[model samples]
Target: MGQLCLVAVMVGALTLALYVDAGRQAEQNAMERMRSLAASLAVNPFVIDAVQSPNPTALLQPYAVDVMDSAHADFVTIMQTDRTRFTHRYPSEIGGTFAGSIDDALAGRTVNQMQDGPLGPTIRGIAPIYSNDGRIVAVVSTGVTVENNNSQLLERLPLIIAIAATLLAGGAIVAVGLRRYLQRVTFGRGPEEIGQMYAFYDAVLHSIDDGMLLLSPGGELVLHNDRAAELLGLTLREGVSAEHSAATGQLPSELVSLLASGKTVENEVVLVGDRVLLVSQRAARTGGKAGSSLGTLVILRDRTDLRKLSSELDTVHTMADALRSQTHEHANRLHTMVTLVELGKGDEAVRFATDDLAQGQRLTDRVMESVDEPVLSALLVGKTAQADERGIELSIVTEGRIPSGLIDVHDAVTILGNLIDNALDAVAEQASPDDRWVEIELIASATELVLTVIDGGPGLRGVSPDDILRRGYTSKPGNGFGRGVGLALVTQAVRRSRGTLSVQDRATASEGARFTVVLPITSDANLNGNTAPVTPTPDRKAPQ
Candidate 1:
């Protein structure tokens, strides 16, 4: 609307200017024409001779009338030097005094002016007529009437209207086009609404804990919040147009490539150094789905802490499962003893109880003697029970005693528990009971710790080891929410401890997978300043 109004005003102003110029030009043309006609008549020999005659009015009147008719002038007058008319349109006034000033004509000069006469307002030109001896004898005046000039001006009305219409049409077209463009880009929002939305956007961008980045379609850094800068370790300034690659060149190559590709991504877990970030990328557009593209929006959520907590929760759940199995087994044994006592077989009952106790104690002793860390020990016990319940043989082998505080308990549990769980899931799919077996080897040295898990199931033949370790690479079928993050978390923990991981086909089995992880066990492994030894007691509460 504003644009239209402005265009309208401009068109009107231009039309008015043209109209004023036309009027001025018309008046100028009329004045020039009248002056030339009067000057020519003043020098006519017939008029000069007649003015010198004893009776000038009779001689000049008819000739003056003929000249007026031929020249198409409104009125032509011939008067003496004393300003007495000799010839006029009104014969009765021919001898009368002229009604307008003739002082310039007496001074032997020509004159042109607008004056009111018997014919009303007119543009008249007066000139002095000279005798043969150069003496001023009479004066001649000719004029174009104001009404006739106005009629001539009215003749150009159609042209003025045409020009004005063209201007109006062009202005309206441009104004409407501009308005439509603004409507699309601004989503039909007014200036006030756009301002309000910008304010809200600014507040939300800085206030959110997650990192947000807006990139241009040409891979330029359009905007990013403080959190995004902090997460990506960027030093950015407002209004600087930095190329996307140069701005984020210090980041992981995979992440930078993903951003540069401008593809739509959702909930992609990317590891940046030791940080586990959940990233999502989406296209930013001006309108709906069919609208023009603005750029891409990349949102980053730090999941490092969440992943750690989740791994710890898995460990706790494993312990709970182990305790439940222990409780159930103890109850069954007690029931058996009660039955024996009721049936008067006390000696047999004692022998049966001693055998069960020895079996449980021996397994516990073996686990404690190998790995003295409470969390790993407890995790192994839970996983063993879980495997036994599924009719799979689980074995734990250790090269040396792995004492407590060699590494973080949480990290150890995350690495060992996720590995064991994956192994169990693998061997559980075997059709033959004898083929379903998993072996864990723990080797602890002065400088490093190595953990290996082997499962008798389908080996990773078609997939690369690096590919399987990436987040969201899972072959097992489930709800798929958390199926693929285990190995990724293991890899993250291993990298945080400056470790290396390897996956291959099991050497002892024809069809099985083996995963081995080596982590530094020295003080250099404490990369996050968490060198303090983890307490031996495990947190038993379930994660909420």
Candidate 2:
């Protein structure tokens, strides 16, 4: 019953995810089409290049609306900036005010809508068209009603229900499906015979997560489940390939090498800004029977955050140890130095350990200054001390003032904090007394914040950039200890800040690698840049 319940929950979740994915895909397609249409209308020769053109129809005359013209086909419309319909699907109403948010878009924003139109509630897209002077002139409105989507769902519903009822095989498990032959074979039989000999197989060449795809034995993509299109970051169009994505960010060379070898392989990969996918393959079965394999199965999970949190936990553990050591050594070292001064061997003892201890103390002191926030400064200060404790030289050089209002404080801390921590790990991975070091640089400008972490270890090698940013790809050799999640989180946060992260082999370094993150600085000139101060509302407020 527990297994059955788990299956049911998975099935239901799969259904919900599919439903949401379909809606999102449809909306995205509609918006892209709207943006393209708006761009086209803005660049129309009749509107821009012609003199004394027909006031309304001339701009729209050369291009017809992109939809089936049947009575049941979903339709779109357009309007002028002043709430006046310029041209729409019902050509007679070219000057009539359209019943939608076309007017809203004319005020200079894209309008994505599900609203009641004269033609019924439609999932409409309205975008502003700009003139030569960059003024909002006309709005392009496009839509397909939910009824159209419902029609698509109805067409797929029967297939979904049939598969659900069949309890089709998923993962490595074989399951029951409809066949009179199976019933006859199972009749009057023992458990083993009934299970193995009597079982009839149903092979579903689709995955239940993100996207699914099946490749034929000839190494061609035979079928693409919906999520596969998304995971590959492709529209449901032809010619999406594994090679295309590998060109953009990076994928494990091992996985790609395996694919190139044309042999069955299952491997996990992280698609930057997408998610982790578990891709596997086996021989495709035939004739609804066992012992046949023909194709590969690809599945995806949005483990983008889970993998991130896991690594953050690890850095936390490392940090905890660093702090523990710092605490243990601070007063004890002070007392020991005092005792050494009282002894006759004071000068010799001071010469031996004072220089390194002073280096550690200097690192700690430098880390604590010029920070507005305590938590961040404290964490970094402790990390700095711990780094010194491990014999790694730490340095922070700033070119100019660290911009105060450039980034959200929390975001700044997380991005820089995690990166520094990761640098410490990379350096400590292969740290030796002679070659123990890391450098952190804060090069800030009015428009950009450049954070670079250079370390001395094995440096960046043996992995693609994607593998470096992937969550679970860890260098620490252990079953349950360290996993590489910090880089993934940093990548995500950097993306959110509209920044870029670059990793390069530190050619000058004797040991480790260097990573640079450039983050955009949001200058305070724009009125929207100023956020309201955090003030508690009257009744909701604790005090004045």
Candidate 3:
């Protein structure tokens, strides 16, 4: 990460330096050309216009022969203060407005290149034609064509390519070297298999499924495939105008600030009329010096349809769970009625059956009443069935609509699955048969999505909160790498969602554990895209 950051910073610094140098050179060139024109006019006072229409022979004879000098600009125009185009460069510009820095110069400010103009849109400076008493006579605006702007673009093109290409090429070369080194040093790759062991990542970069980008640490465009440019609203042209926009604009400030502060940041920047790009980046290095590598490959995944499909998938699972629970709940009620029929206590059994059925229906009504997210509601129903499967009573005690907007269907299902899995894992560990149960309470208020998963098992013991979310820390015996990645994955997933997850001994129950997860409720206002802070809320719980 540090290496990637450093490379990005260097690349940005170099680009800014190059731009400054180029801009300064262009400005200097404009001034020199202006000075030369003024000198020529002083020598022959008969010359006035900029295109040299009248000759030296006419200047010698005619009293005040107004001659336009030879000015090689994209477009040349002579206009009055009211912005009338006198004699334009192109026929198209004959009556166009001189509403640029030329007007400012007529009003006596040393204005340089204002807007698009004729030698095919030029960069120009205006100097007033002065008389003996310093009275302004006319404005002598000299400009070089914007078609000439291509020179600047060409000069810097190689540098842009070098910066972008270096990072990608470095990654490729380094991977190969690393693979070979590991084979030689640590038996990580076998002799026969090493040759066959190929680059899945090489294919990943070229895959058309998603557009890929490699960004410099400071968020400059680095290596991007053709698809990336299309996604990012960048030009398909390698022409002058395209190059101008590519290099001269101010970069997004938030991105630069993130990199400078040594943080790996990822977010979506809209392309105005293009795809909704989900840009995911990690701090990585090409592991080379300046001019040798560009740091950080930023991958852009087109998740528009993928996201919709994922949401649908989650909904399906939630509905399935809900259906399973409904089936089990009905079966249990019917079994009780059958037992009563065989016992011959008809009147009491009938009354008891009615009461029991009412209680069951009330539980269903209460669960279904407040929760509005159909997918989540279904998931809870399935979770109830899962509880029955494990011989434990599980219920969804939602106080309000399943926290709207903050979580999409997919994330909701994921959370539900993790909570249930953790509860099951806890229950499996309980040897003492006292209160072998699990409960999940989901409280959705206007402010938050509060989920509490409680299980009556050996309460989380001898695990430090600081280390609980680490990649490999598990409470299960043997410290084995094999069987303990589930809880860790859940922790990381929560962290990714910018939410908080905490585990504790159940507050209301003594013999079980409770994991409380609070995610800030997202409204429709913030839910249309990826505008989020990915910082994992520091586990504030003191170590147990």
Kindly report which residue stretches of model 2 are placed more than 4 angstroms away from their true locations once superposed: 1-211, 219-267, 274-290, 307-319, 334-365, 368-376, 403-405, 408-422, 429-432, 461-475, 478-489, 509-511, 523-544
Q: What lDDT is reached at residue 140 by model 3?
A: 47
| Candidate 1 CA-lDDT value | 0.80
lDDT of 2 by residue, 5-107 (tens): 6677777777667666666776677556655554454456564432124565655533445432532336545556665765566777677777865656766
lDDT of 1 by residue, 204-247 (tens): 98999999888777766688899988876657554433344555
Quote the RMSD, in angstroms, for model 1: 8.7
Q: 348-446, model 3: which lDDT tens digit per residue? A: 778877897787677667666756676666677666666666666564555555534457656676666666766766776666544556677776655
TM-score of each: 0.63, 0.46, 0.38
Greater-TM-score candidate between 1 and 2? 1
Q: Between candidates 2 and 3, name the one with more favorable lDDT.
A: 2
Arrange candidates, best TM-score first.
1, 2, 3
Clashing pairs in 1: none
Off by over 4 Å in 3: 1-349, 395-406, 472-497, 505-512, 524-544
* Winning candidate number (lDDT): 1
Q: After superposition, how far is residue 331 of candidate 3 from its true place, in Å?
A: 4.3
Clashes of each: 0, 12, 17
